[model samples]
Target: MALLLLAQIASGDSGRVELIAHPEVGAQLLTRDTTRAIFAMRQRTWPDGQAVRVFVLANEHEDHVRFVKERLAVYPHQLQLAWDRVVFSGTGQAPTRVTSPTEMRERVATTPGSLGYLATEHLDERVQVITME
Candidate 1:
C-alpha cells in the first residue's frame, strides 16, 4: 500500500504541494514515511536529530487539504484526529497554524527545524524545499 501510494505520487503531479523546511534543517531529502511522521506529530526531530517544528495552514484551507492528501497521502480529517489524539494524550502537540501561504513560509523560515508545505508560487528562498527520497 505504501509503495502504491508512493508510485502514485511519483507518477502524478505531487508538485502542487511542495514540502519545505527551515534552512537550519540541513537535510534536503526525506522519505515519505518520515515526512508523514513529522506532520503527524509522531517525529520530534529531523534526520540529523535537530528538533522538528511543524507549521501548517488551517484545517479547512485548500492548500492544507492538498498538502495532506497529495504530499502525506492522508485525509485532512484523519490527520486532524491524529493530532488531536496526540495532543490530548499529552504525547505530542499540534502544529502551529498559519492563515496563509505567506505566513506559512515566514513562520517555517524563521522557526528552526520547521517543516511545512506551500504552493509553488508562494515559495521563496527563505526556506529550502526538500525532495522526497
Candidate 2:
C-alpha cells in the first residue's frame, strides 16, 4: 500500500517537478554518507562555490518531522541539541523553518545551492526534488 502511494506521488507529474542536485549530489539521502553530507554544511556549496541554503518544513507537521527524524535515526530532541551546539559554536545554522511545503519549495528554488524535501503531492514546476535512495 505504501509503495503504491509513493509511486503515485513520484509519477504524478514529471514535467511539473524534477529532482535536482548539485553535480556531486548523490542518489540517496538516507545513507550514512549522504546524511552526513546533507547535515554537515559541507555539501552546501555548489560546483561553483556558491553557498547552499537549506529550508525545512516546520515542526507543526508531525509526519514530515517524523520522516526526517526516522530516516536519519535521530530524534527531534537530539536534532535540537545538535543544532544548538552548532549554532553556539558558530559552525553552522539549522535549516530555515517554513510553515508549509509550498513555502519550502519556493525558498529552495529561489535560493542558490539550496536543497530540501517536499511532499510529492506539493511538487510543482517551480521547484525540483532530489532523489534519495
Candidate 3:
C-alpha cells in the first residue's frame, strides 16, 4: 500500500505540481514541513513578518490535492468543514482557488505575500520552487 501510494505520488499526471514563490522570497516559504505548517495554519506569518498568502488549485486535478491531503493525513471533507467553520467564525479565509497551474504560478509570482503551486514544466526563473521536506 505504501509503495502504491508512493507510485501514485511519483507518477506525472497533469505534471509535477510544485510549491512556488517569487525569486526574492527566501527559503522560509519553501519545504514540505513548511507547506504542511501553512496549510494546517501553524505558521501564519513569513519570517519577514509579512502575512502569508495561500493559493490552491480549484479542484483535485493532477492528484496534487490528494498528495497533500494524504501526505498530511488531512481528509478532504474535513478540510472543507474546517474552512466553512473558519468562514462562519470570521477567523481566517480559505485559500484563493485558481483555474489552472499557470494562473496559480502567475498570481503567486506577481502578488506579494503569495504562495502557490504549479506544474514543474511551467516553472520559470521568475518563480522559485519550494522543496518538499
The numbered model that scores best in TM-score is: 1
Cα-based lDDT at residue 2, candidate 2: 43
Per-candidate TM equals: 0.87, 0.67, 0.73
What lDDT tens digits, residue by residue, belong to model 3 across residues 10-57?
A: 775335556677666666435566677676555777778888787777
Task: Please give the TM-score that candidate 2 achieves against the real structure.
Answer: 0.67
Where does candidate 1 stray beyond 4 Å? 1-15
* Total clashing pairs for each candidate: 0, 2, 1
User: 1 or 2, which is superior by TM-score?
Assistant: 1
- Per-residue lDDT tens digits for candidate 1, residues 14-110, read 4477898998788888898889998899999977889999999999998999889987889999999989999999998999899999999999989
Off by over 4 Å in 3: 1-14, 28-31, 70-73
Candidate 2, clashing residue pairs? 19-129, 28-133
Candidate 3 root-mean-square deviation in Å: 6.3
Candidate 1: worst-modelled 10 consecutive residues by lDDT: 1-10
Error of 1 at 77 (Å): 0.4
Best by lDDT: 1
lDDT of 2 at 87: 83
| Candidates ranked, most accurate by TM-score first | 1, 3, 2
